[model samples]
Target chain A: MQQIINFIIRNKNFLLFLLLFLLALVFTIQSHSYHKSKFVNSANFVSGGVYNSVNNISEYLHLKSQNQLLTEENNRLRNLLFNSNVNADSTFIDTTKFGLAYKFYSASIIKNSYTTKDNILLINKGEKDSIKQDYGVISSKGVIGIIDKTSNRFATVISILNTTNKISAQLKKSNHFGTLTWNGQNPATVQLIDIPVNAKVTVGDTIITSGRSSIFPKNIGIGVVKDFEKDVAENFYEINISLFNDMTNLEHVYIIENVHKQEINNLLDE
Target chain B: MNSSLILNISRFIMLVLAQVIIFNNVNFYGYINPYIYILFIAFFPVRDNRLTLIFVSFLIGLTIDMFLDSGGMHAAASVFIAYMRPLLLRWSFGTLYEHQTIRFTTIDFGPKISYLILLTFAHHLVLFTLEFFSISKTILILQKTLFCGIFTVILSIILSIIFSRKTK
Candidate 1:
């Protein structure tokens, strides 16, 4: 027993170093790669709840400012569509035969993260507000994200700027379509791939959502071409686009529910 | 003994709470996260085992990581600093640190200041490198580390002095 005790005492420092080094190695391996443990879901749920509560407090403080901004925006839009001299045909027509095609619900972003590869935004509106998975979300400037998950009072939106997110986009003038992706390099910029080299390109060309998908309406403003380069394949031109709305700065957004989404999905299922 | 232990626990809890709740969220234009939590590890009584000190640091860091949902970034960095601490002490004070317990204020100002600088640098290096794990953007990593490190190091040094003065 004495010898065993002495042995443990003598080897204690080495053992401690070994233990710490191993712990560090384990943490480094887990963090430096994408292999985050599955158990993190519980942590996310817990922290997410805390984050939600704190966000609610901050959002409450900002309610007056938010209301003021909304009022100003409402006035601007009202002046745009209901301009007193506008022709009746140009105005929003009440087609009695048409269904409620699009429903918009105002939502406040309760939690936001942009640094992760799969960034998600949690909003205050959810199932109770008719916010469902796959519903589209946008700020005043442009497209923000699509709903990925929902609870009774909260829904998570996978932002277009997320590394895993790809949406159909195109050059505004030419209508030549491409896929928009975040290169994970900068938040201000996103990459557009699959634009054929044959199409004319310039540094300042504007890009817009193609509306190829049923999620978003056509010609929504995305970004302007900040730079352009040829891809490794050389057959296509890859365009670097600078986004219009700063995704990090978003607060309140509109959740879009396409009335025809189910029909479109059913058709695509075939 | 019981009251001191409770006092230490409350102090540590308060430090962690303030650091995470206030400092971490304040971007200061994405340039600062004043990590005052290290002061808890720094001011731990001299008699505690080195291994225990390291373990405590790990626990603290892991708690922060859990809140941030950062997996283990803080834990890794904290452990790295903990591992290097003994070597840093030995180098800074030669054999004095090994033979005697360190009281920061009573120690010669030279050794104490140097000790603070070295440890602060070591901690910041590990934290920033782990936070930015990829070498693909080494320049950005360096920029962030240097800017945040300078501000945080200054704050930590000032806090340490205040702490030591009060205790004295």
Candidate 2:
């Protein structure tokens, strides 16, 4: 017993290092897996508050560009509203009167990272704002990511650029679906796999969400097919897509809540 | 002792902020960002308690991880380097380290540069390996380590020179 105690005391530094290293490794594994250890994340108050303050100063410097983006989005929305055909004799119908499928709340991105293999974004909204995990986040230009974790006043989004993130996407014209993933090489581009060779895809064809998942709604723009090649086995076509949103410079985004998600999930479970 | 403690605390805060807010967003060539924060561990006083250095390294690394949302990759790498720093110092400084007469500011340019390069590369290698965490990404891991290591070493050298007190 005396020898053991002496040995432990002598090697305390190594023992402490081993203990801390193992703890850190546990955090790394938890984060890599689908289920993250929540306490170690950035959605908490201290880190989130720091990001919020920094974003405020940077956001001020970006007012001109942000205003320009908002104006363009507004113009596009106005065109869609005024250009739609409505019969004069038909009674006006309110879409939200019956039930809304998805609810949208606007939020700003405080921190966005795309240079790493696993990227995450911090948004200004959280549980207090009704934001929750698995909610879909999108910019006006395209899909951004899915909310992964939320605190009282902040949330962390698993970006589409993350190698671990996979979204159900389809070719806009032909409705052929595949999995959208990132190669971790380029921030502006992502890859789609499992697209069949017979899908009749071409460069510049639009890609959109397939609505197969409960998070994002149908028909949200993702990107355009940039290039493609058949796998060696000739079974599937691997495609690269150029994103519409310059993810590196994002500011404003919308968090989407699927109202019927629980019902749909229950039905599928049966 | 008091002034050194204050200096280290301020350095910890400044490096964490500079890393997440400034360097994390630099995105040179769309993918490479220098991990300048490694300098915190690099410039830490050599005579401090090894256990405290290890703990401080883990704390700073975890703080950066929290802001960047990168889990504990930084913490693991920082701890590993802090543990190995004694050996690295011996290897780089030879007689100076053995005699406990080394001062970073007064070190020869060759040893100083080599030490920074070696430390940066080691940290980057461990960080990228744990981050990618797959055998298939060997090429990618090496690519990132090389590019990021070079950038980090360059920045660390420049910062050291700028911050170092006059030797004379």
Candidate 3:
């Protein structure tokens, strides 16, 4: 017993290092998996508050360009409104009002990272604002990412650029769909896999969310196909897509809440 | 002793902030942001209490992890480097480290630069490996380590020189 105590006392530093290193490894593993609440994240008050104030200054600097983007979006929406013909009749049934599947809330990005393999974004909205994990986040132009975790006043987004992020996306020209993933090589491009060779694919073809999942609505623009090649086995085509949203320069975004997600998930479990 | 303690505390805060707010956002060529926060572990005063250095290194790393939402990759790498620091110091400085009379500010440029470069590369290599966590990403991991290591070494040397001059 005396020798054991002395041994421990002598190697205390090594033991401490081994303990701390193992704890760190546990935290790393915990964070890599989905559906596990991470003990360490950026959604807490201190870091979130700092990022918020810094974002305020950056938001001011970006106002001019932000206004231009807003103006363009407004023009596009106005065009859609003007071009669609509306017939006023008491007997006409409005199908659009009956099926409001998604709700959107405006939020600004406080911190955005695209260079890392598993990038995450910190946004200004959180549980206090009714935001929750699994909520889909998007910009005026296109899809951004899904909410991964939420604190009281802030939330972290798993950016689509992250390697772990895989979204259901499909070609605009056909119903054929595949999984969207980032290659960790370029922030400007992501890869679409599991797309069958039978699908009519061509360069510049648009890809959008399939809405097969509860996270995002259907037809939300993702990117345009840049190039494609068949895999070594020739089973599926690995296609590269260039995103519409210049991810590095994003400021304002909208969070989407699927109103029937709970019902859908319950049904699936049965 | 108290003043140095205060200096270390402030240095920890400043380095963490500078890393997350300024350096993390740099995105040079979209991949080469230097992890200068390793500077804290690199320049911490040498003492017999290796345990203290390990604890401080873990704390600083965890703090950065919280800000970046990178889990514990930073903390793991920081602790690993902190544990390996003594060996690295002896290897770089040889008899100077043996005498226990070496001061970072007074150290010759050759050993100092080599130590900084080696430490930064070691830290970055561990960090990227944990981050990628795949054998397929070996090339990516090495590429990130080399690019980020060079940038970090240059920045660490410049910052140390500037601060050392202030102390003198």
Candidate 4:
């Protein structure tokens, strides 16, 4: 017993380091997975407030550009409104009832991270804003990410740039679908993997969300294919895509809620 | 003694704010991220308890990780470097490290630079490796470690030199 006690005393530093290192490893593993860990969620809960305050200041600094983008989006929406048939949806008295297919909620990114391997974005909207996990988020230019977790006043989006983030994307021309994933090499580009070799792929072909999962709607813009190559097995093609959105510089975004998602999922279950 | 405690607390807050608010946004060419926060672990009082240093370093890393949404990569890296600080100091300064504080102005130029460079490199190595967590990006990992390590080392040295008053 004395020898054992002395041994522990002798190696206390090493033991302490080992213990702390293991704890950190646990945290790393937890955060890497799709499920939100309590530690990370709470961390976001606290830091989200600080990020929102900081973003308030930075948001003011870029007001001119932000206003320009908003103006352009407004013009586009107005043009669509003028062209579309107002009589077609007489049952919909409220403008919010654009369609039963999807509902859009505007939210601004409070904190965005692009340099990390598994980048996550914090937005000002949260549970109170009717934001829920697995909802799709997009900016005016293209798809941004999926909501991973939500607090009372803030939420975190697992940015599409994350290595662990894989969405079903397809070529807009050929409809050949593949898994879109980031290579952790470039923020502006992503890789579409597992595409069959039989599919004809070309540079500059547009990619969009497949909507196989209820997370996002069909035809949301992803990017244009920059390059392509076959995988080691030669059975699949890996295509490089240059994203449309300048992910490093983003502000306003729309959170998409698929109204018929539960119905579609229920049908699948049956 | 009370003043020193207050000083350390303020330094902790200041460094974390600088790292999260300023340096994090400064993504130079999307590769080099200067981590001057390790300077806290480097400049910790020599006579302080190692356990306390480890805890503090872990907290510092966790704060950065939370802000950056990087899980625990920063926390693990910070703890790893904090644990290695004493051993590396002994290697660089031999017995001199035993009785003296590691303030940049007080330490000799040769050992100071060596210590700073080695620890910074080690911290970045662990951080990028854990961040990547795969052998496929070995080349990419090395590239980031080299560039980011050098950048952090240079920044840390400049800050140390600028802020460090020569011990009277």
Best by TM-score: 3
Index of the highest-lDDT prediction: 3
Better of 1 and 2 by TM-score: 2
Best-to-worst ranking by lDDT: 3, 2, 4, 1
* DockQ score of the complex predicted as candidate 3: 0.80
Residue-by-residue lDDT tens digits, candidate 1, B109-147: 677667766776777777766666668867876777677
Model 1 lDDT, residue A29, Cα: 56
Return the DockQ of model 4: 0.62
Candidate 1 vs candidate 4: the lDDT winner is 4
DockQ ranking of the models: 3, 2, 4, 1
Candidate 2 CAPRI assessment class: medium
Candidate 4's displacement at residue A175, Å, is: 3.2
**Candidate models: Cα lDDT each:** 0.73, 0.90, 0.92, 0.86
Tell me the tens digit of each residue's lDDT in model 2 across A128-240. Answer: 99998999999999999999999999999999999889999999998789999998888999999999999999899999999999999989999999999998999999999
Clashes of each: 0, 0, 0, 0
RMSD each, Å: 5.2, 2.0, 1.9, 2.6
Candidate 4 chain B — worst ten consecutive residues by lDDT sum? B98-107
Give the runs in model 4 whose Cα sits over 4 Å from its true position.
A36-38, A41-45, A87-99, A267-270, B100-105, B166-168
- Across residues A103-173, which tens digit of lDDT does each residue of candidate 3 receive? 99999999989888888999999999999999999998999999998999999999999888989999999
Show model 1 residue runs off by greater than 4 Å: A1-69, A76-106, A110-137, A145-168, A183-186, A210-220, A255-270, B25-32, B104-108
- Per-residue error for A121 in candidate 3, Å, reads 0.5
What TM-score number comes out for model 4?
0.92
